[model samples]
Target chain A: LAKTTQPISMDSYEGQEVNITCSHNNIATNDYITWYQQFPSQGPRFIIQGYKTKVTNEVASLFIPADRKSSTLSLPRVSLSDTAVYYCLVGNSMDTGRRALTFGSGTRLQVQP
Target chain B: EAGVAQSPRYKIIEKRQSVAFWCNPISGHATLYWYQQILGQGPKLLIQFQNNGVVDDSQLPKDRFSAERLKGVDSTLKIQPAKLEDSAVYLCASSPRTSGGTYEQYFGPGTRLTVT
Candidate 1:
């Protein structure tokens, strides 16, 4: 498992675009970067995932550089409801027949009006 | 599709007492995971099971924590002689095994345990 580093907290205003970057300098070739969003009293939910380059979905977009050392999650048109803690995790597929995700202290995003 | 289900949304117990939590994963999912999330911290994987067989439990405190999944479906987690440090939310998640090895996990509303 590759250890990840991210900001502890970030502040944003409504209707703005927010980008949260995660650094995993020791990332492995087989590892993929995945992000999750967690609100108060709820379990984390999958937001987006990417191996390299850019991947976009209906909700968010994930951009991974060629080096794969760092990735960014871009949220468009942020709203107050977008406030939550975001987690960045790096792990390979279930090659060992099991999956164990190591989660670091996530970056808490506060979207204000 | 029904999502993961957990019981006893909240529990409060004193130190040295015993407690138990239950989880029902999404239908037809083959992998289940148990995680512990303390206040102000990200969730930590405690155990993982594949169709009733233990795949990894390296992080679980076997001396006081035990989990079982019977018939490869429903599961239960038990803690004996709990301590204050054990106060945390117990999360149950399930994922379908895919050939690509990229299975998205679905988590249930966790069981909040407060060891007072």
Candidate 2:
């Protein structure tokens, strides 16, 4: 499993777009970038995933450059409810039918009203 | 569809005491995972089960933590002689097996254990 590094915390205002980047300099060729969100007293929930380039979902967008060494998670029009800890994990989690996610400290995104 | 279910949502135990948490994964899900999340930290994988069989348990502190997914549906995780540092949230997640690289997993509310 490749290691990932992200901001410890970020501050944002409501309706503002937030982009959190993660650095995985040692990412492998087959590794995929995944992001998960967790609110207080809840388990982490899958947010978005991408192998390369850009993958946009209803909730967020993931942008991975050609080098695959780094990725960014973009949240549009954030709200207070969007305040949560976001984790960036790099691994081929779904390979072999096992989704073994290796989580880091995660970036705590605080959306202020 | 019912999501993964975990109980008793919260537990308080003294050091050296034992506690158990139960979880029910979504129907037909073949893989179940146990994770330990300490306060302010991301969750760490404790164990993984693939249809009643253990797939990985490298991080499990086998001396005190033990989990089982008998029948490959509902599962239980037990902590024997809990310690202060053992206080954390135990999360249960499940995902269906697939050939492609789809990283989707459903998570339960989790069991918060406080070992005093």
Best by DockQ: 1
Chain A accuracy of model 2 expressed as TM-score = 0.93
Q: Please, what are the lDDT tens digits per residue for candidate 1 over residues A3-113?
A: 899999999999999999999999877778899999999999999988889999999999999999999999999999999999998886564322338889999999999
Instruction: Please state what fraction of the native interface contacts candidate 1 reproduces.
Output: 0.53
Lowest lDDT 10-mer window, candidate 2 chain B?
Answer: B96-105
lDDT of each: 0.91, 0.90
The number of the candidate with the highest TM-score is: 1
lDDT of 2 by residue, B1-116 (tens): 99999999999999999999999999999989999999988889899888999988888899999999989999999999799999999999998876555557789999999998
Q: Which digits, one per residue and each the tens of the lDDT, describe model 2 over residues A1-113?
A: 67899999999999999999999999877788889999998888989999999999999999999999999999999999999999998877455322347889999999999
Superposition error at A71 for model 1 (Å): 0.4
Best by lDDT: 1
Query: Taking the true A–B contacts (Cα pairs closer than 8 Å), what share appears in each candidate?
Result: 0.53, 0.58
Q: RMSD of each candidate?
A: 1.3, 1.6
Candidate 2: lDDT over CA atoms? Answer: 0.90
Off by over 4 Å in 1: A96-99
Please state the error at residue A113 of candidate 1 in Å.
Answer: 0.5
